[model samples]
Target: MGLSAVPSGPGGEASRTDPAPPRDVAGRGAEAARLADLVARSSRGHEDAFSELYDLTASRMYGLVLRILRSADHAAEVTQEVFVEVWRQSARYAPDKGSVLAWMSTIAHRRAVDRVRSVSSEVARDEQYAVTTVVREADHVWEDVEQKMDVERVRKGMASLTAIQREAIGLAYFGGYTQTQVASLLKLPLGTVKTRIRDGLIGLRDALGVEE
Candidate 1:
């Protein structure tokens, strides 16, 4: 699907046809294995490995970020941030936790979400603050500790979600977009978006050990 232009930050429009860097997949077999190896080597301070990883995943990651942000330039910037985090946190990645692409995609999603949060309307920002304030007012100690833990649990659980489910939840809750808006942004049917959000929430509830 073709993406429309959204206003960029200080810089002008990002080159939609930016040149792709070289990829080194000589001995790599399956896509998952290739990504895993590059991530492992990158964690061990292999610059070449890191370069290859970027070459392999950057475009796709950038595209995903662009979809969420709706700005080519900001998407490019956030995609850079995502790779920086990937280089820094690759060692912490566990194979049992998820595939390398999924891990990287999670990082991309989070960075894009953060960028969107920063650019979100003041009304939404104030609403988020009000919600936080209310939580703080009720059983301050428990809310503080449990809220942190629950948020972390949900973050972890989010990575395990199907791509559509994860994106739907991120757009609705994190992007401060309504479900209809999320559906529009994602170019998915409203019913599909609703189902993904409902199912994603249920999965997150289980992850947080909340009773159904």
Candidate 2:
């Protein structure tokens, strides 16, 4: 049996194969430029411009909050607080310091840290499992394969440190425990905990090639 030819639509002609339409590249560029201008104006107390800036940056700011907080409920709460802070402090942002995204990320980072620390020590002790869950989730979010590799590199750089120094730093920073808390948890002297944290930070600063 011979294969039947497919029928064309309408005209007695072969169907035309249309090429994909071109994207609105210039439009996107113009929109981004407009948003940047709006943010600049908003930073100077222009209410409408501030609204537009909020629209542009809110999702990105939320993503950062979620990554750090790891609880959708807490993240949402923090996201609102972050924008409120941005609206109040917009005038303090200096373009020379960094881009809008960086400034917003910095704000989110500080706020997340503060929120994490504000959980009272007693509550934190009682809710250790909850804190561990949040930290594990945050590690999954922030330390993907690439970031894990970077962490390994950082660990290698701190190779000169004794096990106690490494553990002290990890508990204080990654575990979000205060020095006194770390000492209590590790059953170490308070002074020893302090020395380990300070020395470990100095060692890590060198290992990670961070400047003073």
Candidate 3:
């Protein structure tokens, strides 16, 4: 059939037309399925599958480790350890348990935590403290520029907060005190400390525009 022309509006201009949006759902589903298949194959000693899996997850795993350890060198070391462990334990992964990404995150978290604990222990020992003297000195230098800026921002944010809120946040994050420990340190009731921490975090999140 011959098409009929629609009448133009106002200044004889045709109305603007919008194009259909691209569909990403099928692509994402295919990628997920591919990763699952790769993981399954890697478990059975498929080197190509293992390499592909590593390529997919390495950046994410390294970023996770770096966030926890806060040191590039340590993050690199832990990332290497994580992939080594992943390769060794690939056979232990069960499809029923979780996604491949979740399994990788769990391993990365454990290794990063272990590294932190190990460093803490070494720092606690007097003999090894000397060996870490350089680390301390470097930290002092770095703190003056980078950390000082962070501290100032935190301090400014704290200044905008109630004294109790600032206290709660300081104890929890800087002092590494748990809610119970924070309560103990401040000689406040545990419930009060909990409330303060919750409120403080909310305020900080709002102030910093952190996504919930």
Which runs of model 1 end up more than 4 angstroms from their true locations? 1-29, 120-212
lDDT of the structure predicted as candidate 3: 0.69
Model 1 C-alpha RMSD to native: 18.9
- Give the C-alpha miss distance for residue 201 in model 1, angstroms: 10
Q: Kindly list the per-residue Cα lDDT of model 1 for residues 1-212, writing each as its tens digit.
A: 33345465323434434322112122222667889999999999999999999998886697677666766556667888899999999899998887788789888877777677674522233333444445446644564453455456656788878899999988775564778889999999999999999999888766544321
Which residue pairs show backbone clashes in model 1? Answer: none
After superposition, the stretches of candidate 3 with alpha carbons farther than 4 Å from their true spots are 1-27, 120-212
Q: For model 2, how does the per-residue alpha-carbon lDDT over 118-188 read when each residue is reduced to its tens digit? A: 75422332443466567667766765564466557666767867788888987765555678889999999
Q: Model 2 scores what on Cα lDDT?
A: 0.67
Give the clashing residue pairs of candidate 3, or none. none
RMSD of each: 18.9, 13.3, 11.8
The predicted structure with the larger lDDT, 2 or 3, is 3
lDDT of 3 at 56: 83
lDDT (C-alpha, whole model) for all candidates:
0.72, 0.67, 0.69
**153: Cα error in model 3, Å:** 26
Model 3: per-residue Cα lDDT at residue 27? 41
The parts of candidate 2 lying over 4 Å away from their true place are: 1-70, 83-87, 93-110, 117-152, 158-160
Worst 10 residues of 3 by lDDT: 15-24
What does candidate 3's lDDT look like per residue over 1-212, in tens digits?
A: 43345454323423223222122233445666677788788888899998999898886797677555656667678899998888888888876776777788889877776675575632432343344445656666755454465455555667777889989987665444468878998999999999998898888766544221
- Candidate with the greatest lDDT versus the true structure: 1
Task: Flag clash pairs in model 2.
Answer: none
